[model samples]
Target chain A: MKRWLLALVLCLSPVFAQHPADSAFSHIYVSIEGGEQYPFGDLIDAVENSFYGGVGFRYAYLENIDGFILFDYSYFKPVPEGVKIYGAHQFSGKLGLDFKWKAIAPLAIGAGFVCDWVRGDYDEDKLDEISFSNDLGGTLTDNETEFGWFARLNLPLIRKETYKVGFNALWKELWTLPKRSETLSVGVYVERRIW
Target chain B: MKSFGKIVKSLVAFCSLASVGAFAAVDAEMEGMEVDQRDDGTFLVGSPTFFYDRILGAGGLHSESEMWSPEKLRQRMLLDRMSILPSWDVMEPSVWIKSGNELGDMIYRDFITAENRPTNRTPILEGGFRTPSFKGFWVTGRAFQDDHFTTSNFSYRKSFVDDEFAIFGENYPMFSTMYAGFGYSANSIDASFLAGEEYIWIFSESSRWIPIHYKPRLEARIDASNIEATVAYEDAEYQDKRKKEKGARKELNGSVYYRCGEACRRGMLQLSAGLAFRAVDDSGMVYTHLEEDRAFLPFVNLRFEPFNNLAMEAMFAVNERDWLVQDSLEFRPPVPRYTGVVVGVKNISGTRLNPLADGEEYFDGDTISLKADGQMNLVQGYTAFSDTMGNVGMGGRVSFWAEHGAETFDVDRYVEDDQMVYRHGDVERINSWIRGVTGELWISAWYREMFSFKALGGFERVDGNSSRFEVTPVEFFTSFTADWLLRKSFRISQSLRYRSDAQWNLRSVDPLVVKGDWYWDATFEQQFPAHGLYLTGTLLHIIGSETIETPNAAENRLRFICTVKKTF
Candidate 1:
């Protein structure tokens, strides 16, 4: 069975293999951006709007699809003032799918997914650990994996050279099930293509 | 702390690779290098970028400063033991794909929120694709990493007929939408089943053709979990205990809706049916019991428009073999067998379906509502947890422009017998009967905005479910909220709640006392135009009271907390 499985995987490899388009693509432009959160009153404040910065390559998949892979790190400090809670710093590698086919270019419909492997360290003194070894709720581990789906339409018609303008309607669901929560965001993004 | 950072970094790298694979192709068009040779292509490696942030003292770690100092300081020390904390980090090399709608693509981004508010400084990198291999069908796929979570999913959606191309298109528009997909977590923490608990689920849903007439949809899901054995020695006694458990659940739901006329857009009717099944196996010290549950529920929604935004929505459900409550009897050798047997294993059943403290019965109830909504082209919303701080939380808000309704349950009969006979082995029969019931009501309403800057307070009163041989209870819950964003970039939020205890029989109990909490955060941001870099800092605090209870007693508590964050 193992041999057969291996053979099958090898045979299917070429079928699912990805291709790099052969065409004359321009640098368009290179850009860097980042932001961060600052909690003033509560110890348990969140890492909302926290600062972040990264640089990446840009390409035109087609006249409609442009993609980029970016590397960035995010830190979430459980700023619950008097209480000490564990904080997490995440390193992420991201890929994006952008669809452009509408009256407005930046406002095209888009859907994509993301995966991240996270290593989290606990300030045991700061965060309380719930031990399932002594009971049934389960044990707290050091790593986290996230998977989710996002559907939205870009309304980035606000820029002349780049179409990263306008408001986007987003419907995304994220869960770490059993112990999971979901988020639904309806917001806008302003994008500019630098050359 | 260093190890944790390493783990997070590696996982991020793995996810980035997975995303890159999910993509069908990467196209880079650079005017200077392209077309040099048709067969040779250049793959430019991009620099690894980093987005950094620090949220010091989040999670209300300082709330109970006196008792929680050790833990609070430990968290701060992870970032260098300063009254203020800092988080340092870096990330993956970039592989930019032309972002667009295609088959098999990916998107990735890293972001940090200051003070952890909904106001996002989120960076998004996404990519994916869709391809039409055959004439009328296509497969669309993509992967992405962002502020909230990471996800990768695919959808095979195809229209039976392109309405625009139909020569004799129906006067009414008709379209079919269907999809089936499976997803797995790239982040272990997000995985459903871990360790002894294992869980994975596959689900699909679809709908077909409808205009103003009738529309229908069906959804289904299944999930499972498990466990194992061990040994222990205590007080010179060695004991061997082996245990295991497996549980699976399935659900199916279908609904249909139709419209009657113009005044009927406000006056439409719909019907829905659903079934849920659950099975369990337990082999643990706490309890060893196997249970099965099956339920079929059917309901309908009817609306009547006597005026403009004023309409009525009546809903009801019919339940069979429904388990309102489940009971089991168990005792140690020390207890009296007769007494234990007499009340041991007493299961109760009734027609009341709704569990709300309000005087509403899902068995037979309807709501009449009046609503007027206008679109100003400006939309906004907020997260429930955002207002509560991390100490406690709840999400999802169903706003009521206003609502009024009446409900009643029918009681055919009820019987009672001697309780002593079962435990003592004395057989005796007694006759008993209960009465049925009917009711009427009316209500006017006014409400406040949820998750908003406005007031958050509400009250409810109940007056029904009282009948011969029937259980009737009334309860109320009132809550208030306050949050403010100050001129100097300071934010403060607080909430308070009070509710009456739940009761089974016609009796009033002391109301549950819930104290409010005041949570605040201060922030500052600066941009370096010369270097194209940005920086920010924040301070946070939480103050409140909470109540805790044990089988023996209950006590209230006072708490205070503080934190800080800096990003560059």
Candidate 2:
């Protein structure tokens, strides 16, 4: 947990330090977020809960809308015992639009697309020691990726001229094999406005 | 004034985006992967290399690629088909990278269920850059490959090669290509020369995939003033380690054409002429052998519009060994201001669809003839009409075609090797006449430059000895497509389509049926005009069953592709 937090902070420190707003826009926000993802349905038996940290770029899209792009990284452990690999490293990229409906001033609803790329964290020198035919984590040893759709709610807790604090929760369904995999993620972010 | 210019730019981009007819994101990593984008035909992809693509209204049993034209002179001759996929065409001035994979890999699902484990999904990788022109001179290089369908008959293909048979990875994909070259561009003058190595699998007349390796394929092209010319030399090596057979083929092919200039194109009569030729030399046990090791053809294309609403177009190609002629005449009677109608008659008569192709294919101790006796002729009459009122529009077309001596396959028997099935066959023609009727309808609506929606449907019925034809095409298909641009920065394109079942008659003992179903493909793109950067993600085959469309091809599974490109 400590290492994750430190990495998250280090990954986002430079953005907060440089609040350069040269380009003109009604709104622009650079943010750093940390979140926990929970597997749903059959996926719960596949992977355990994991924490993720990511950076985001938000820009004004329309009078009542905003667009955001996100990049996140997480480490997931297999729920099944006796898996061949230690854990899986996953990188997530998302592109979404937030609808800041006047009816819900500070709260916005959004839907977008998500892409996840994953590879098992294992030792390469021991490739000969691995057998993949029926193993749980064996397939992850090779790079695996999936694309899906996500819907999220964005709530701004504290808003200011140059900074803001917000909470975001999203549900994503991955188009995985046999059946689609679903997950819920909740995170809080600190954002600074940049052009 | 600056803000107004920005709005105009946005409108231009939006209009251009919506004009693409929703080619859908059927795999942007490769050209011609848009087989799903074709609805007027029976299209089946055996692999990235092999497919049976026949337009229903095209009025013949042979696939479109099996026929030759001057327009396809630059296309790679893959066995009996002229294909542009796995093409070597250069790109616009841009730096780009694309990556994608077949979607159904187990991922986490592998941990839970041990039974019926899914096959490992394969990936596609592509990256290249064409440098911005440096005073009319530029350089470009590319390395690309698709490992998607290689897993279907992995072991069988792998045993034919000593090593991976690809630039990278152990998967013996259907094709792996890498090339680099330089080009010069100026007003009315463009020239380029490229050399590269490629590994490709060509599907033979006997339903076998023959692997060919081009160690250094060289191509040079120039388009200056009103003339365009191209030439290529290939040094291909063939090997089937399983059978301990090895062969080599050296070939040279090219074309030179002259078209009407800009000023002449404005006149009522326009003309274009070209000559295409191929010369080959083979040694050892080559799978296919060309007749007399040489072919030379000269072709001409003409368009004559003597008056308004009436036009005639014709293209004719002839050589010592073959001759082909295609001509179309159309008339547009006066109609309402907002409505249009065109009635046309088209005819195609050809001694051989592809005269430059090899004459014979050697497979499993059987000599398979690639050419059929006699000639084929097709005639079609079509009438199309369209009207627009306000923001809504509708159009429809109906065509009836008849053909004599349509090309087909005569299968003696079938052979099974590993997971793949092969056939012993000779190309033959149906002497009796075959007929088909096709109808298509479409409706569309648009709102300024922000949104557009189009729905299209088509049906075709074929008659007369249809069972003997190599493929019985789909009967009907429908598609719903839409495009939306939000705030001039984000674009969304989506399509949902369904096609009826199609069948292949002679590839196996039991006819192979390609069950058809609904498929959803979508593409999302983010454009930063100021930064000249574009990021796009596309998903394909969302709702369709993962079924192989051809006899020995792999499943056409759901896949996703993402690209990041920056135009200069």
Highest-scoring model, DockQ:
2
Candidate 1 positional error at B226, Å: 42
Candidate 2: tens digits of C-alpha lDDT, residues B144-249: 8888777777777877888789886656788999999999998878999999999998878787778899999999999999999999999999999988999999
DockQ each: 0.02, 0.28
Using lDDT as the measure, the top candidate is 2
Separate clash counts for every candidate = 145, 0
Tell me how candidate 1 scores on lDDT: 0.24
Fraction of native contacts (fnat) of each candidate: 0.00, 0.52
lDDT of 1 by residue, A1-195 (tens): 212222232223222223334321333434343444232222123223334444434455444555444445555543333222244555544444456666574456665443333443456554444331121111112334344444555454455655444554444433232222222334444445664
